[model samples]
Target: RRGDDGTALDRLAGAITYAARLIAGATRRTGLREVYSPSSSTRGLRKLDSWVERALLEKDESLSTATAVAAEAIRQDLPPLFAEVVGRVLLRIGRLPRDMPDAGDVAYVPRAGHHMPLPPWLPPSRILGGFYVLRPIGTGGGGSVFVARRAEERHEETAETFALKVPAYNGAAAHTLSEEEFLRLFREEAGALLTLPAHKNLAGFVTFDAGAKPKPILVMELVQGPTLERLLDKRAMSMPLALSILDGLAAGLEAMHAAGIGHLDVKPSNVILRYPDDVGAPARGSTPSPTPVLVDFGLAGRKVRPGCGSPYYGAPEVWDTAAFGDRTDPRATDVYAFSCLAYEMLTGKTLFSGDALPVLIAAHLTHQDGPESLQWLRRHRQAQGLAEILSLGLRRDPRKRLTLSEVRISLAELGRKRLASLSWPLRN
Candidate 1:
C-alpha cells in the first residue's frame, strides 16, 4: 500500500485506473504471437492473481471490502472483446467459516448472474455511496430499489427518506459493448432522470450519482403507499378514487411525453397511491383524497428507447417490436399501457392472461373490441365517458393511439362528474 491519504475514494480510483490500463493493454495485442508473449502485454493472466491480493490494504473497510466483493463477482465470467482473451476467473462461494469477519456484506448475484431473482437476505445497515442504506423495497427488470436516507443530514431538504435504485445491468445486454461502454450507458440512462419535468403526481428525482463505485444510485422522494397492483388485489377502487387515480396517472404521462421522455412501464405495480402520515387502507372518495404517484424510472427514457413494457400492458407495436421496430413511438406504448391499466382499474379484470409470453403477445396483437371492458363499459357509459376514451388509447396502431394530453383532458372532465361505483369482478 503506497500511502497517500489512505482514503477509500483515492484507493478505489487507483484500482479502477490500474485494471482499466491492464484491459486496454491486453486489447492492443492479438494473434498467436500475443498469446505466446503474454507478459510482454499486460503481464498476462497472472495479473489477476496478484491484483486481488494487492487491493485495499490502507482504505476504508466498507467501500474497499464491497469493491473486492463486486470485483470478485464481476470477474466470474469476463468477456473477450472482439476475440481478445479477456482473463476470466470463475468464483463460487464454497463456504464461509463461522468466524463472522469484520466486514458486513449482502446482495449475492447468484450463478445465474445479475439478472437473477432477488435473493432473500436482509441487507445490514451500511453506507452505499452517499446514502445510508435502510432496506430494499423491491427489485425490478433493471434495478433494485432501497428505502434509504441521505448520509449527511445537514441540509433540511435532504433529511427525508428516498428511494435509491442500484443498477442490475443484464449480462446479455453487455454482449456487444465493452465493460466501460456498458457502465456509461447505465450512467447516461440514470442521468436522464434529472431531465424529467416536475409534476405532483410523479415521484420527484432528488439526485443521481453514477460515479458511485461498484454501482450507480438514483434518489427519489419516497411516497408512503402500497403499489396500485397490491391495492387492487384487496378490493376494486371506488368510482371517484379510480377516476382520480386515472387523472393523476394521465397527468404524469402528459408531463413525461411533453418532456420527450416516456414512462414506458405504466402498470399497476409502478403506480403508488400516496396517503397521509399513516399508510392505511384506501378509504371511500378517492382514498380520503390521496395523490397517485407514478414511480419507477428504470426504463423511463427517450420515447425511442424502453422498447416495450410490462406484459398484458404493452401495446401491439411494443409486443411485436421486431416488426414495428424503430417505427414505434415509445410514448405511444405508455398510452396503450395506461389504457390497459384503466380497464383493469374499473372492471377488476384484464384483457389478456397467459402462462407463457408468446401467448400473451398473441392476445395483445389480435385483441379487438369496441371497448376492452365492453360489458362494463356498456353499464358505465351512461354514467361517465372514460370507457370510450380508454378504447381510443388502446388502438393497435401506435400512430392511432390517444395522446397523453387527450387522456389528461378526458380524465379532468370526468373528475367533475358524479361517477357510479365500478362493480369490480363485474357481472354484466
Candidate 2:
C-alpha cells in the first residue's frame, strides 16, 4: 500500500507495524512458548530465527530502516524475533552476570572470551547437583554436552574433568520427540555407557542422576581432543595416521560388540583423537598419538532399531527392512559404517555425498559399486588391497559384510608402509 507521505517518519513506523503483523501472522501470539505448540509442523522459534538472520543481513533501504526502528521502538514486551536479535547483540557485547536459578549457585560461563555465548534459551546453571558445569562443548538431537568437573571447593583437585550430558529440549525445534521421550533417551544413553566396561577407546562413564529436579544429567570422562570430523576438515591424513585411527576405532567397536552392545553410529565425528598433553599440536609427526576415543553413545546399545543412525554412513541392512529388518547383526552394521569412514579417511571424500536424504538412502540400498573417488586411488600401491577389504565391509548384504574382528585381521595383514604417504601428511 503506497502511503500519501512515503518518506515521512510516521509513515515508516506504521509500515513497520503492518509488516511485523503480516510476517509474524495477524492473529498469532508473539510471545515465547505461546507462539507454537511442541507438535506444530511449522515451529515459531525457527521462523523467528530466520527473521533475525534476515534483518541482520538485509541491505534493502526500506527493510533495513524497518528493522532499525523495530530494534529501538520496542518500549516493552519484545516479540520473539526482536527479542532474539537484541539477545544476540547483548551476548556479543559482554557484561552478562550469572543469574542463579537457585541459592549457593556460583554460576559463570567459563572462558566467555573463547566461547560464543550460550543462547538465552540454554543458559546453564554451573552447578548440576554434584557436578560443576564448566562450559558447553557441543549439542545433539536430544541433549547438550558440557565440559564438567566434580563439585569441589579445593580448586586444584578440580583438574580432573568430565563431559556432563544434560537433556535439553529448549532448542529441540527440529525434533518431533516429546520432552519426556527425549529425557528417556538420555537416561538410556547413561545406562548404556554405565553398562560397558572401562575401555581406553570409549568415552568411559563417570556418573549420572536420573531423578534430578528439572531434568536428568549424564556425566562421562571428557576426552580432551578435537573430533575426527574437525581434523578431516583441517587436513588430509597420512596413511599411517589414518590406519592408526581406524585401528583404534575398530578396537572400540569390537569391545562394544563383545560386551553385547552395538555402536550403531560410527562416523568421523563420533571418533575423538585423544593426544598426549605433552604433544604440541594435533598435526601428524614423530610424536605418538593414542588410540582415538569414540564418543556419543546416543544411538548406541544392543537393541535392533531399523532406519536409524546417520544416513550418510548407514549400511544396506540399516536402510532396508526386507533385506535384514530387526534381525540385522549389530556388529556387521558397525563394520559397514566403519568402512564408510575408512573409505573417506583413505580417500578425501565421502562415498555417497549429497543433500537429498531419500536419494542417498536409495544409493545405500542399491548402489554398491565404487564412487568417483576410486580413480583418485588408482595407480596407488596399497589401493587394491585396501579396496578389497573395504568391499567386503561395504557389501549390500549384511551377511556378506566383514566382522569387526575380520576387518582388524585384514588390516593387520596389509603391508601399508608401501603407500609412500604412510608417515607424514600435509596439514593443508
Candidates in order, TM-scores: namely: 0.63, 0.63
- Residue 322, model 1: Cα distance from true site in angstroms: 2.7
Model 2 weakest 10-residue run by lDDT: 1-10
TM-score of candidate 1 against the unseen true structure: 0.63
lDDT of 2: 0.61
Please give the clash total of every predicted structure, in order.
0, 0
Determine the backbone clash count of candidate 2: 0
- Global lDDT scores for all candidate models: 0.61, 0.61
Per-residue lDDT of candidate 1, residues 231-308 (tens digit): 566453576677777888888888888777777788998887777764554333334667789987866766344234
Which 10-residue window in model 1 sums to the lowest lDDT? 87-96
Query: Candidate 1's error at 81, in angstroms?
Result: 52
